[model samples]
Target chain A: SQQGEEDPQALSIQEGENATMNCSYKTSINNLQWYRQNSGRGLVHLILIRSNEREKHSGRLRVTLDTSKKSSSLLITASRAADTASYFCATGINFNKFYFGSGTKLNVKP
Target chain B: EPEVTQTPSHQVTQMGQEVILRCVPISNHLYFYWYRQILGQKVEFLVSFYNNEISEKSEIFDDQFSVERPDGSNFTLKIRSTKLEDSAMYFCASSSDLEPQHFGDGTRLSIL
Candidate 1:
């Protein structure tokens, strides 16, 4: 069974627009991470927010986690065409393993 | 720059043949993991290794799959025999204590 699910399985926007994707999980997590993968490629780590943290940022990426809701959101502000990719949220629990969400395919039109 | 590296970027094998996928993780990372993603599907975790042994694995990681760190700086995943269902992109990831994992480019495996 999948522990995490992403909303809006697909999204499309202009290059300069902001894109947001949300993920919800089932169990207690030690931390949550966001990753991006270009088509047919390996995942690239974006940002990770510990259970104690509510928000984190890297470059134009902003990640927010709400443990109470078992949800996390990733926002890419002023996105570029290069930012287009499939975004996945993974939940890391006690097992030291990460369970990934189905992923949200984001298309940034140039 | 320091990063995880995988070999043979792609592999094609006959069904029922043995195949080994290799990875070289970051020099200082202590944990290793294997994941797979079929075309148009979400990535799935296969196994996690630490201290030279499997600490955890998913249901998809059946008896046919095995992992080994034969020597320092090298990690490998072996499938005793391949099946059509085994066709997918296999990825290796590594991380140190309390750090987010770093991923390799992955090996695309095709079962003929």
Candidate 2:
């Protein structure tokens, strides 16, 4: 019954700026994952941070987790037009299934 | 470079009709899953399949729902009688070696 809720339901910024999105969950999790969806398309996995990992980096994407707060944050630096999409955070429990948040719609205007 | 593949990228079915969504997970993956996302809503897990059986399923996966991996390479989600509320994007995903999932493009089901 645990659900993840993302902060900033919508974000609009000029290209080249940094976009930050935060997610908070209701219960403990084995890992948290970030995904991006372009309009009505399927989700594309962006990054995953385990409970024990405080932070992770992949290219221009950075994810940090605070299990104590049951929260996670995703930072995308040097954003581009292609990066415009909805970002969702998913909490993974023991079942290997995940619960997703409402998501943050990021629009990077060129 | 293998990925989950879902067929009939889009489908429109009448309400109360049966619809089966098909997905072919990664060739070597053992775990499979089905998820649905309504327009402008969060993704909801429908079920997870492992070892030819359902490992877990969400409440939304009620009596009308069933999953099968009848063949070695295909996994399916069947809705006995789809409702108008069933309109959503159904995604299939697979994980190998217990790693993160790789998702398919998804099948958009629009119940009329």
Candidate 3:
């Protein structure tokens, strides 16, 4: 079963704009991770936020997790054309298991 | 920056036939997993393997599906009697401890 469900199935933005994607999940999780996939390719790990932590940042990416609300969000600041891709959120239930959501496709126009 | 590698980028097979998808995970990674995505669908987890045994599997992984490490460097997923619905892009992933999983480019399997 899918754990996370991302909102705003698709988003279009211009370069230098900020893009935010939200994900909601149903069960308790040890961690939530975000991933990026270019067209027809494999996934690339973006960021991860643990249940004990509310937020985390890496480069231009910011991730927030709200255990109480059972939701998480990813924000990309100063988006570039290269940032155009499909983004996904996955909830880790155990060390070896992760359940992923249908992704959000983001298009950053140059 | 080691990455997982999968072979036979695309495969076309007949229904009811058997097919094997192969992957070689990062050498030092301890966990391996298999996932699949039907066109325009979410990536779905099929199975996870550790210590040369299956640690977890989703409902989609039925009796027709099997996994094997086979050798030190090879991980494989085999489907016996493939169905047309099995057509999908299958991905292999590996991770070390709590690190995020690294995914392979994936094999596009088409069952005719």
Which of the two, 2 or 3, has more DockQ? 3
lDDT of 3 by residue, A1-110 (tens): 43899988999999999999999999899999999999899999999788899999999999999999999999999999999999999998777889999999999999
Which order, best to worst by TM-score? 3, 1, 2
Higher DockQ: candidate 1 or 3? Answer: 3
Q: What Cα-based lDDT does every candidate model obtain?
A: 0.93, 0.92, 0.95
Residues B1-112 of candidate 2: C-alpha lDDT, one tens digit per residue: 8879999899999999999999999999999999998887889999998998888999999999999998999999999888999999999999975478889999999999
| Model 2 whole-model lDDT (C-alpha atoms) | 0.92
Cα lDDT tens digits for candidate 3, B1-112:
7889998999999999999999999999999999999999999999999999999999999999999999999999999999999999999999988888999999999999
What C-alpha lDDT does candidate 3 achieve relative to the native structure? 0.95
Q: Any residue pairs clashing in model 3, and if so which?
A: none
Each candidate structure's count of clashing pairs: 0, 0, 0
Poorly placed runs, candidate 1 (over 4 Å)? none
TM-scores of all predicted structures: 0.97, 0.97, 0.98
What are the DockQ scores of the candidates, in order?
A: 0.79, 0.75, 0.89
- lDDT score of residue B35 within candidate 1: 97
lDDT of 2 at A55: 99
For model 2, state the Cα shift of residue A69 in Å: 1.2
User: What is the DockQ score, from 0 to 1, of model 2?
Assistant: 0.75
Q: What is the CA-based DockQ of model 3?
A: 0.89
